[model samples]
Target: MTVTAADTVPAATLEPPTGRLSPLQQWWVLTTRGLLKVFRNGEFIFAFVSPALLAICFYLPLREAVAQVATIDYAQYLMPVIMLQSAAFVASSASMRAAVDGQEGVHTRFRVMPMPTAVPFLARAATNFVLLLVALACGLITCLIMGWRPVPEEYGGGVTGAAIAVLLVAMIGMALTLCADGIGLVAKSPEATSQLVAFPTLILGMLSTGFIPLNQFPEWIQGFVEYQPISQVTKAMRDAIGGILDWQRFEPTLWWTLGLFAVAAVLLVLGTRKAAR
Candidate 1:
């Protein structure tokens, strides 16, 4: 039988799950479903291949030329941003997944089910986090293949050094995912959400210090390049690995990241209300 929205239970019944699984368990069930969809759609392979491809595409043509400009091996200079490219990919994937759910009225159905209010958000976040981690691993392996290492003076001081850099990058990746997921909910279609995010990702990724250094940019725009979020993250990760990360350089980016998280939270609240209606 075809059931209309009027036939569905009210949001009151969606109160936190009671008997079967705890709220946490209910959330995990949805999370597992999201993860399975990702795997079945072959996003897993793309998640791995996209980062490696970014590393290769940038490293091949510009290595020698950029080496002279940055005064470091181009591979080392390009390393952080390469991982960032992967992070962006993961963020995009988050949007696609959320948009799919929204379009299919999955959020609407969940709202009427007997689960906690936060379950949908948590389930989406859990799936995105796992995929982001996988993307990070793929990016690391790709960088290593192209000559990035934890050399004390160069790449990283070893595990400790790499950890610091990775932590910062992970935080940024999570923040981006939050915003993208919100966008997906609002857009309510996979294609729409993906299209909406592409411009910002392309502009920020290219116009920042990801591929080219600050000095390489025009004098007038150099400040913008230095201050942008992507450049800040790339600089933070690079400095951490090199054992030079400090409050001064990282502080602004931290603030920007926090602001982004706040924006995402507000958007999510609004989106949930929209889905409920």
Candidate 2:
């Protein structure tokens, strides 16, 4: 029991447990990790490629045909829908990411961690926001290359209008991403998530006025086509870019986006609770 100097352990002073990360810091770390995952999985590449493909597919074959019927510039007319399509792509990716996280128990792990309950969801939202921006940028570039211009003659929105158009896209895109992410959290698998996301996106995008003028649609379903969320949001962005955005033009889109935000919030809460279980 003779304690030698060598055996004398200094009173093992414990460094205070490292301070917990602030919510912002926690969100940033999670967001960075999510972005890295997105890049490695090649979603980043698709963010660029998908829009380009969409532009070519729609603008090349249909441009001439569209011109024969409507006196509008196909590229200009098609830009808003294309932008919305890019948002849909982002939403699909968000859905898959959330599904994968849930399937792999990432959310469950977060539930046990010493962070706010909302951090993980917020981080996912931040990651989706970045991807949405990338998708939007690619969509814009593709449209520009295909002859869509931000000229006053085309949209008449000028700089102010262009800014509004961007804001509208961001708003609608985030709402879509959040909603898709919520669905994804409860999805059984990424495959299922993709199917869930694709069906509505296809139905909405194809039926909307993005590819053609509303007047061109058959008289039967034009009312549904006009009032649907996709068409309304697309019209808002188009008019904003054209510098003609007004309460009358934007009211429906605003309502739709708000409704989507509320739905997404509820779904996310349920999803988080499900993950905790």
Q: Lowest lDDT 10-mer window, candidate 2?
A: 6-15
- Give me the displacement of residue 249 in model 2, in angstroms: 0.7
lDDT of each: 0.86, 0.88
Please give the lDDT score for candidate 2.
0.88
> TM-score of every model?
0.90, 0.94
Top-lDDT structure, candidate number:
2
lDDT of 2 at 104: 87
Off by over 4 Å in 2: 1-7, 13-19, 153-155
Report the poorest 10 consecutive residues by lDDT, candidate 1. Answer: 151-160
Q: Mark the regions of model 1 whose C-alpha exceeds 4 Å error after superposition.
A: 1-19, 153-156
